[model samples]
Target: METLPKEQLLNSLEHLVDGHLQQAIRHFQNMTAHDLLQPAYNGGWSIAQCLDHLNSYGHYYLPKIQQGIAKNIHLPPKDTFKSSWLGAYFIKMMDPETGKKKYKAFKGHIPAPDLDAYAVVAEFIQQQENLLIYLKEARSTDLNAIRIPISIARFITLKLGDVFQFVIAHNERHIRQAMRNVTDINKRILH
Candidate 1:
């Protein structure tokens, strides 16, 4: 098995986490004031709402990870995956090693929460910042050795390393959603 070198894992995760954050920030930076508030779709979430929803996963679930870490107990994991064409595409896009770890998508699309766009963007940034800090301060050995609190049915024993990967990937998943919101809004404005 090709295990990730300590340096590579650290570098990749740092870059991955920060890069997606930058992507999300830059996406909104160019938006006009009107573009920022556009609904994600007719009768659907606004671009802002979409960010909040996408970010809420981290905000909601990361604390579980902290609780698990603090208590040294396993958390009942919630899958934040979707089953749309985009979800399927990202699954296929993952590196084979990562493909082995993530939870499978549910049969239907996961719904984005309805909320103000500013709230969504703010929460997303907060979650990303928190995760980066947690990961940055923890040791590679701790990450590679900690027993993750995962589900019983999944039959996968997750290491801190695995958990680290999941957090990073999960962040990326939402960043993609945030990006979609931006794209959708821009398309609407141009049309």
Candidate 2:
């Protein structure tokens, strides 16, 4: 896929971030504690757990992106961002449309079974807001030059633009997972 122009990329990402925020808030508004905590199937994560997983990622990436933008605030904005080959590959892998590819969660990022649903949902909403801010902040920097270390290996890094793309795509993947969990639970209840 071709890289988007900087303004276009940021605009698209903002729309995605805001849409997810609204959808998640609306979805969780009606969910009871029991509904939120119940797993989709035996041994599977609940909607809350899936969101908590996304929250864990947000916790890591949001700060790194923020710091990169702040440190590079003096740099002039660029018209375009050329994602690194590896960065592009990672973003593609994270895209939900690529089909489901099971990836093991990093040990530290895994959600505990006993998570409070309301709190987890609230945190996810907050993280999405933060992501929106970072996307706006990123417009002023050369996205390709600002590097953020991957959570898997601090030694490995990707450009800020790629990191934003990965994070947004990853969120979409899990939001769909969480929504599916909710649908499954509702179906089982109906049956």
Candidate 3:
């Protein structure tokens, strides 16, 4: 992973987090419960399902991040983060902008099809807010020095910076999926 100035990196991350928060709020603001729960097509996930999937990820990653930050609280902050090669690969793979291959959710991360749409949206927004807090905590630590375990394998870990990047990118991907689902539902309803 290439080195980036700390301030620049933090700013970028803040932008990403804030964008998620804003987009989520706007997307769900006026949506009816029916719209939120409606699937795009037969056997497809609803907006609630997309949010639930992201929430499942948050349930795993947020705690790991918090623990890592607490453990590394005494360490001095660094000016740049050197991302792990593996972590970088994961982030690249998950980034929606890359138009890379889609991945199936691990069994544990898959959300139930039946979920309350409002509750799912609320949980997702809360998780995003929590992520913003973690990002702030990260500003005072060496992002590269702190290693967080992957949800898939507790034995393997990635640098904190890479984990954050991966989480943000993943969120963006799913959020976009949820938006697309909403659009498709609306189109079908109109016709």
Candidate 4:
């Protein structure tokens, strides 16, 4: 994997997070509870489920990342980040564009069937807000030096930069899934 400028990587991740914020507010927030609960044409997860699933990950990762950032705050931020082979693999797997492969959600991350739509969306928005703050704080620390533990594989920890990339890409994948559910629902209504 090629080395990336730390600023560039942060900017890219921030842009993705901003898009997610817009999507949640403009699209998901406006959706009706029933619509959010409706499954996609492929019988996949509903919009609320998608957000809830992401929220689960956010709950697990945000604190860990925060701790990592805090521990490494004394270290001056580096100019570039070299992706670990494992980190690169996880990021590629999470990317929606490159990773089309489906995997079952960890039992802990699987969202419950009956969820409060408004509550789920609200939590997702808050998580995005937290992510923005973390990204900014991370600028003061060495992204490649700090390590964050993964929720799925606790034994393996990835570089802070890699975690950010992986988590945001994962969020993008599910956000697209949620949007597709909405679009498919609209098509059905039109028909």
43-156, model 3: which lDDT tens digit per residue?
667888888999998999999999999999999999998777898888889999884787888997887877888898888889989999999989999998999999998899
- Window of ten residues with lowest summed lDDT in model 4: 36-45
TM-score of each: 0.63, 0.94, 0.94, 0.97
lDDT of 4 by residue, 1-191 (tens): 89988899899999999999999999999989999998777878999999999999999999999999998899988989999999999999889998989989998999987899999999999999999999999888899899998897899999999999999999999999999997898898899
Angstrom error of the Cα, residue 96, model 2: value is: 1.0
lDDT of each: 0.55, 0.88, 0.87, 0.94
- Whose TM-score is higher: candidate 1's or candidate 3's? 3
Q: Which stretches of candidate 2 lie over 4 Å from their true place?
A: none
TM-score of 3: 0.94
Q: Output the better candidate (3/4) by TM-score.
A: 4
Residue 71 deviation, candidate 1, in Å? 7.4
Candidate rank order under TM-score: 4, 3, 2, 1
Among residues 3 or more apart in sequence or in different chains, the pairs in candidate 1 whose N, CA or C atoms overlap within 3 Å are: 40-45, 48-117, 52-120, 74-149
Using lDDT as the measure, name the better of candidate 2 and candidate 3.
Answer: 2
Total backbone clashes of model 3? Answer: 0
Q: Give lDDT for model 2.
A: 0.88
Q: What is the lDDT of residue 69 in candidate 2?
A: 95
